[model samples]
Target: MTSKPLISVIVAVYNGSKTLQRCIDSVSDQTYPDKELIIIDGGSTDGTVDLLIANNDKITYWQSEPDNGIYNAWNKALNHAKGDWIYFLGSDDYLWKRSVFEETSSHLFKAESENIRLVYGQVARVTKNDDICCIEGDSWDYTRRGIVADGICTFTHQGMFHHRSLFETYGKFDESFRIAGDYELLIRAFKEGGAALFINGLIVAGMQTGGVTANCTKLVKETARARRNNQLRVITIPWLISYAWAICYPSLKSLIGDKNSRYLVNSGKCFVAVLSYKKNAILEHNNN
Candidate 1:
């Protein structure tokens, strides 16, 4: 006679009216019944508040107020979460399917007894036109190496779920990291003693390509800083390679478009039979 664990979905947004409805609809239509949706708006003036009010019935709790940044908004939302598992859903992103929660519930149920702090799968990176760019995420074996040794983030937060105990133990997102705070928090947990489980073949969300994280230089710099702050060395070869790719990716995407740019990158890597810290799921498909 045990009840299903509750999942608190937190969305932090600003001026996100355009895609917010899609995001809200995706969450509201989920098949899972034991879930709550919480949203924090960064005092947007672009009609985002209106949208929030219209969808108030579906939201467990929502607020429209100025916040420092994404992490700040997320930290604020944490104060109101009352679930065993927490998920951060981007206002510009949506769950890949309505059944995502129902499908992942069994994994989350099992993770409880195993004490796994992170349960993640893959996310589809899409262009503004909604064309899939690539699938992002790797096995924990690959993720652990990137986080622990290379100080790289090999997974997207949109596809990851955090156990409540992780926050109770390591605390919430670091507001200092504007773009890489999510990565920083994960680093703290994994480096200090946290276990993660990766669900293969599960594509949890579709993440739009452009965002604050699209500023490659700032993102890479902040990622490096987070690693340094977490006691990881900053000069690893993988880190250097990531920095180089970050610098080039924007211009490359601009010239060839997002989908083509990713295809080219993966194609080049496949020819060399070499893999970096993060492996693209598309590469395997393209190779075949």
Candidate 2:
């Protein structure tokens, strides 16, 4: 009989003692036997190291040191990972269910034969209180055009599994990117003809809101950089509009205050939705 492939779960955290244990527990509770947990701490001073010590037996490898950012920490963790498939989990995020690895491995086994480098599922974005905001993810076929054209990341990293071959071929995450380095790597791979498989209706993890990726303006700026780094044009219409919105959002927020800024933003979104509805309605009438 053949041995099951090992999956490495890498978590990068800084001062996340409040939720770190839950993240670790999520991995430890997994039904998959062939899995390892690797954690990289960014010199957290908030007793996070103590928690790491408490759960030392459950971790395959862990380290505490100062790092530039999340990508840097992830790069560090990657050095110690020995699994066939790699998944990056956030400190504030948890596996949606204990069977995540068990279920995902089924697809991975098939993906291996097909030479697929990326396998992704859906992620639920949840509030701090555990209320789900929305589920995020889509097939590469549905998202490739947007990613290639505008550098928009439709799938959450927490829900994606990367084959070790991907790292061996394309190299690890770029350490300089404070955000969207994942996007750069994915864009590079897809644009270069790497294959990806999407597992339909598989909700892999729950990503908590208000993390580093929640900085919309900074994320947008990093996204543009990621696109340019991958040789993608920065002047695409979708990117232009997103860039404009990102640039204006902060100024508008500071000028008006959080409450009003949110109202104004929601109002703008509603107006766009209404226009889209009206246009669709007219088109339907014409066709009828």
Q: Against the hidden true structure, what lDDT does model 1 obtain?
A: 0.85
Q: Native-vs-model 2 lDDT?
A: 0.82
> How does each model score on TM-score?
0.91, 0.86
Local distance difference test, each candidate: 0.85, 0.82
Clashing pairs in 1: none
**Top lDDT hit:** 1
Q: Local error of candidate 1 at 28, Å?
A: 0.6
Clashing pairs in 2: none
* Clash count per candidate: 0, 0
Please write out the lDDT profile of model 2 over residues 85-105, one tens digit for every residue: 999999999999999989998
